[model samples]
Target: MREWLGWLDHIESVEDSLNNIKARIKAFADNGGYPESFAIIYNGEIAGTVGFNDVNKFNRIGVVGYWLGEKFQGNGIMTKAFESLIEYGFRELGLNRIEVSAAIDNKKSRALPEKLGFTQEGERRQAEWLYDRFVDHAFYGLLAEEWHSDNRED
Candidate 1:
């Protein structure tokens, strides 16, 4: 985990919310009162992780967060990985809605939710801080009903 965290810091474009890198991994493993974390691996290396940030059981809604290291940018790896994760969210987790957000300047990230047909709900100006700077984040969502209808076959 230190390797990944150090890579994030070195990139200068990536920011993580933990003082201790292993602590973050432990918390994710423990779930802190949430569900499991999913990893999409490629060639036996850590590709990335995508999982629920907020999963409301009563409402059956989940917010997913994903991050890919700088070295693996592009090549459509994240898209292929995310499709499987999203499918698991809707099918296995039985979630009604899956939400994703990206910094407005992150053109690479904005494409993920868009390609998946998520509805853009506008930007949150100065909503979050990253690398000592504030950034606008664009919110998006996809409902299970829409997923089923859009991807189903006759």
Candidate 2:
């Protein structure tokens, strides 16, 4: 996790994890769920989380972010979770565009958006500083029209 999540690099105790959860909850409340997050539960345990961040209601855009536990990988959990999240983003949240980015080297992470029919927008050079070094990100985007057209039932 530390290899991908830089914030975990400094978490030395359980309290730090709890504090982070607290902060996420507070942010959800304070922002009226603009940055809504959901836990990915598998076998009654939290596999990970998926969320929308940097939401702009006026612009009808948001960024999707997610992480899955190692054990939860390859189980199709994140894909299903993303399917639901994207549905909600388009149908309920009324978003026109939803973007996602993954570290360019992280193939597993990058595969999700690609598999879900998101268009490869571009690359963000040195988009994130992960502890010791910087990491580039490959950006992907899905617009409401695109998603709807691709997902429509015949």
TM-scores of the candidates are: 0.75, 0.89
RMSD of 2: 2.1
Question: Candidate 1: which stretches are off by over 4 Å?
Answer: 1-35, 152-154
Top TM-score model: 2
What is the clash count of model 2? 0
Q: How accurate locally is residue 102 in candidate 2, as Cα lDDT from 0 to 100?
A: 87
- How good is model 2 by TM-score? 0.89
Residue-wise C-alpha lDDT for candidate 1, range 12-124, written one tens digit per residue: 43244334355557655665443445666777988877777677767888888777766777778888778777787788778899998887877777889999889998889
lDDT top scorer: 2
Q: State how far residue 50 of model 2 sits from its true place (Å).
A: 0.6
Model 2's alpha-carbon lDDT is 0.88
Each model's lDDT comes to 0.74, 0.88
Q: How much is the lDDT of residue 93 in candidate 2?
A: 81
